[model samples]
Target: MTNLSLQAVKKAFGPVEVLHGIDLEIAAGEFVVFVGPSGCGKSTMLRLIAGLEEITSGTLEIGGEIANSLPPAERGIAMVFQSYALYPHMTVYDNMAFGLKISGMAKPEIDQRVRRAADMLQLTPYLDRHPKKLSGGQRQRVAIGRAVTRDPKVFLFDEPLSNLDAALRVATRIEIANLKEAMPDATMVYVTHDQVEAMTLADRIVVFNDGHIEQVGTPLELYTQPANLFVARFIGSPAMNIIPFDVLKGGDRPALLIKGVSETVVSLGPDDKICAGGTGYLGIRPEHLRVARDGDMALEGAVLVSERLGELTNIHLDIGQDDPLIIKVPGMIAPRRGEKMKVTFDRENIHLFEAEGLAV
Candidate 1:
């Protein structure tokens, strides 16, 4: 097991700086995932950790040792790229044994490592099979096995499942998770744009935006108590519904008026505070909104579209806002187009963001 630390790390190309100062600590044997949109510097950070890119400033420590000057092979780290990068002509066994062979390891030791990795990855049955004979998921497993046979202290995966189809991706993801469980002492850092992957596989997730860290927390922490508007919108599927409003009364129990919805004065809980006459945003998840009962505070809107997705239905409503407010309902539902509907949410489920986009 190995721990990693990045102190004031920065990366730049020419005069263009992409990664702002980033400081993070990854514990030994912990699985940390970096997630963000494209061009967000997540991959660049991974490359820096793998010694594939030079850091313009700051320090990188691997296993309590300064590793900025170390070469990739000397860093005791193995990287699995998005592409499998397997040799087409070599069988699974030979491919896995290639690196150990080149390193002049004893024949018996090489065979033992290869067989052990193959069994761990469920690739033992296909050891003699060529890459062409393996499915996409199997080939990806072979790539992982090759890395495992090297006995690296740290493992870096750069969107390893992106190349596979949806079903194959899910299968490969499970395999990777199992591999982590089997090798509990191996430190891992994974980069992906898929939140599902980050949520399911990581012990902790680091959310990045542009070139800076947004927030770092467990999946549920990030989902439930986002640090700001960016994370609140980005972390959830279907995205949180944000409705702009003007603060009517300030203090512990502030009141807000929805910008587009007239005559609606929403009173926030005591924990929510905002200055008077300032703008604020209300964020609610689709699943949190429900059909309004009598005498409940509600926002009325006309149904724009309803998508029936097996287990649940996502109904888009036009409530005079720029974007349609979505409500997720259980089971099959086919609301009529332009049908007027009233929805309300609980006070605890509401997220209040100040004008500066910070959560109150």
Candidate 2:
């Protein structure tokens, strides 16, 4: 296992900078997943780490040694790409052993490594099969097994399951999780646009946006206490419901006025920077909103749509806002379209953001 570090890592294409002074330290044996929207530099950063792209500036270190000048082969890193680039004519065993063979490893050692990787990936039975004869998931496993046979210090995955079907993706995701457990000492870095994979598989999730590291934390930390608006909306499913509001009063507890809706006071921490007569957004998760009881502060709206997804229902309400306020109700409670409803969220669950989009 190797500890990786990037200090002020910056990448540019001539004059246009893609990554701006990125500094991160990844612990040995940690499974870190980089997640963001497309063209956000997550993939570029991965490529830089894999030595596929040269860093414009800054230092990159692997195992406490400078690796910025090293080629991919000498970096002690193995990469598994999104596409299963397996050799069609070659058997799985040969494909897995190809790298070792090219490195002039003895036949006995190459055979041992191939067999070990195949067993670890549950591909032992299909070792003799060609890529065309195997299923999509099996092909992907063969690709991963090829990398595993190298016994690399760092394992890098770039959207390794993006090509698989939904069921295959899930199954492969589980396999990856188990692989992490089995190879406890191997440092793994994965890049994915899928938040579910990032949340479930990462020891720590790195949220990237617009070529910047928006936030880096445990999955629950980023979900529960987002640093800013970008992260608040990016990490969750269905996203957090954000409503523009006028601040009537401020302090530890701030009163906000949602025009044409309702006035409510929400709790804020002592360090939260908010002021009276300011404008900002009030963020509430869908699951946080519930049917309001008497005397509770609520937003009245007409139900525009409701989705009954087995155990929970997602209710979209037209609350005289540009975007509908979404509420998640327990069980299958389907409300008729245009039906009036009042929803209230717990004060503790509400998030406050400044007009500049920074969390208050």
lDDT per residue for candidate 2 within 1-360, as digits (tens), equals: 799999999999999999999999999999999998899998899889999999999999999999898999999899999998998889999999988899999999999989988888899999999999998999999999999899999999999999999899999899899889889999999998787899999999998998889999999998999988999999887889998888766344646778744445454455555543379888899989999998877898999999999999999999888999999889998999999998888778888888778887
lDDT of 1 by residue, 1-360 (tens): 799999999999999999999999999999999998899999899999999999999999999999998999999999999999899999999999999999999999999999999999999899999999999999999999999999999999999999999999999899999999999999999988777899999999999999899999999999999989999999988899999988875445668888554356788767556643378788999999999998888888999999999999999999889989999999997799999898999988888888788887
Could you give me the TM-score of model 2 versus the true structure?
0.94
Give the lDDT of residue 255 in candidate 2. Answer: 63
Using TM-score as the measure, the top candidate is: 1
In model 2, how many backbone clashes occur? Answer: 0
Candidate 2 whole-model C-alpha lDDT, 0 to 1: 0.89
At residue 360, give the lDDT of candidate 1: 78
| Maximum-lDDT candidate | 1
The stretch of ten residues in a row with the least summed lDDT in candidate 1 is 268-277
Q: By summed lDDT, which 10 consecutive residues of candidate 2 come out lowest?
A: 260-269
The parts of candidate 1 lying over 4 Å away from their true place are 250-253, 275-277
